[model samples]
Target: MFSIVVISNATMVPDEAAIIQQLFEDGLEVFHLRKPEADEQAVRLLIEAIPAVYHNRIAMHGFFHLMEEYKIHRWHFREEHRQETTKEEMMRLKNKGYTLSTSVHDLPTVQRLTSLFSYVFFSPVFDSISKHHYKGVAADDFYLEAEQKPVPVYALGGVDARNIRSAMAMNFDGAALLGTIWKEPANAVENFKLCKQNVQTY
Candidate 1:
């Protein structure tokens, strides 16, 4: 099954929370709460808006405490965040029942995460307007790296309704969207449906 991950940004906060909830209700499989600057209160507020049934389906980036509080099972951590926590620490986290995921910019990093994570995110397969200086990795490069991965690799960055089919054709487990959904709250539900339809067609 293909998954749709909704990536959050700081600029769009509680205002966008209800739209996010709508996406989840509309069949968005995963939601990645990535507001690096958002405080604990902001996170709590957003979670509260989302129904309890979907809590476990949501993934938060680097908020272990919140995960425990919300009973969230999926968690994502960037390489830099992984560096702060040791492998043994990660193992302990896994023992406590967190489905760990991490980001990779290259093949070597992908290789390193094989044993540690259940999924890896290979980003920037296309230029992303939401992020500055994020010159994406070529599609061919991503395919080569994904071929060697032991776990599922999600294609992130610059994914939208237009090019999602291409990403799916490459055998990505799924694609993540940030700007495409958050930039236009009113269209989020329909946009997500269109993206999912394209994925199904491919």
Candidate 2:
């Protein structure tokens, strides 16, 4: 089954907590808190704003402090963040009970990451506003690469209610969205519902 994962970009102008709550209410399985530029204080405020009940359902990306404080065991780490880190370091993080996820833009990177993390996000399968000028990989190409991957692969970038069915038809384990959800926070619930419906039908 495909799932909806929201990528909360801290750089967006409007605060999306209310929409996030609605998504939570509507049954979003995982919320990836991915505000890379936000300081520790800002991230804490965001984390605290979320209701306690949703804490276990949501996962913080790159916020180790939140993990320690809230007992969140899932993390999404970027390639650059793990560049100098060794396998021992990754094992240490895993030993702490964190289910680590990472992003891979190419096959070589995907090969290197399969043994290190539980899942991988192979992105830009479609044009993305979050990463301007990033030419996306063709859906067929992505599928071909992902079919060989040892870990489950998620299709990220430019995913929304409109194209979610197509994403599922391509056999992605799941899909992740950033601007599509954050851009219209007030409509988040409906958007997520629509995407979920499409995913089911596809």
Candidate 3:
């Protein structure tokens, strides 16, 4: 299946709990909770707001320890975070049956490392939608690397309905949207629908 993973806004979404629940109910595959600024308590509160049944579909980018108590089965570590985490520790986490995803900006890392992950986010497939001056890889460059894709690589930067087809055309396994999902509507749920539609139609 062409997967769709929705990432939380860097800060917080208005009525985020409601929006996330609606998206899950509406058939979102993965909801990546990525509040870089929030502490463990705040993260707990956010997770607590969602229905218990949907918790397993949620993945987090922070507070790894919370995964055990919260029973969160999926989590992602940025490349830098992964660097800080010892390989043995990461393996231990994997052995415990947690699905680990990570970020990779270089082609070689993907070739060498994707075997270790459930999936990986290959970013800036188009351009940066949120960060200032964050240059994205050219479409040709992306395609060149993507042609050798060994695992599920979710296009992460500047992904939206209009360009999701580009990701699919490049043979990406899925698209992980952030700016489009958070900035498009009164609630981000509409964009989630659009994203899922694009995944089907693109």
> Which structure among the candidates has the greatest lDDT?
3
- Model 2: per-residue Cα lDDT over 31-65, one tens digit each: 88887688888777777877878877666666676
Q: What is the C-alpha lDDT of each candidate?
A: 0.78, 0.76, 0.82
Pick the TM-score winner. 3
Count the clashes in each prediction. 0, 0, 0
User: TM-score for all predictions?
Assistant: 0.90, 0.89, 0.92
- Tell me the lDDT of candidate 2: 0.76
TM-score of 3: 0.92
Shift of residue 142 alpha carbon in model 2, Å: 5.1
- Model 1 per-residue lDDT tens digits across residues 108-128: 777666466877788877778
TM-score: the better of candidates 1 and 2: 1
From the highest TM-score down, the ranking of the candidates is: 3, 1, 2
Which pairs of residues collide in model 2?
none
Better-scoring candidate (lDDT), 1 or 3: 3
Off by over 4 Å in 2: 12-15, 139-142, 145-147
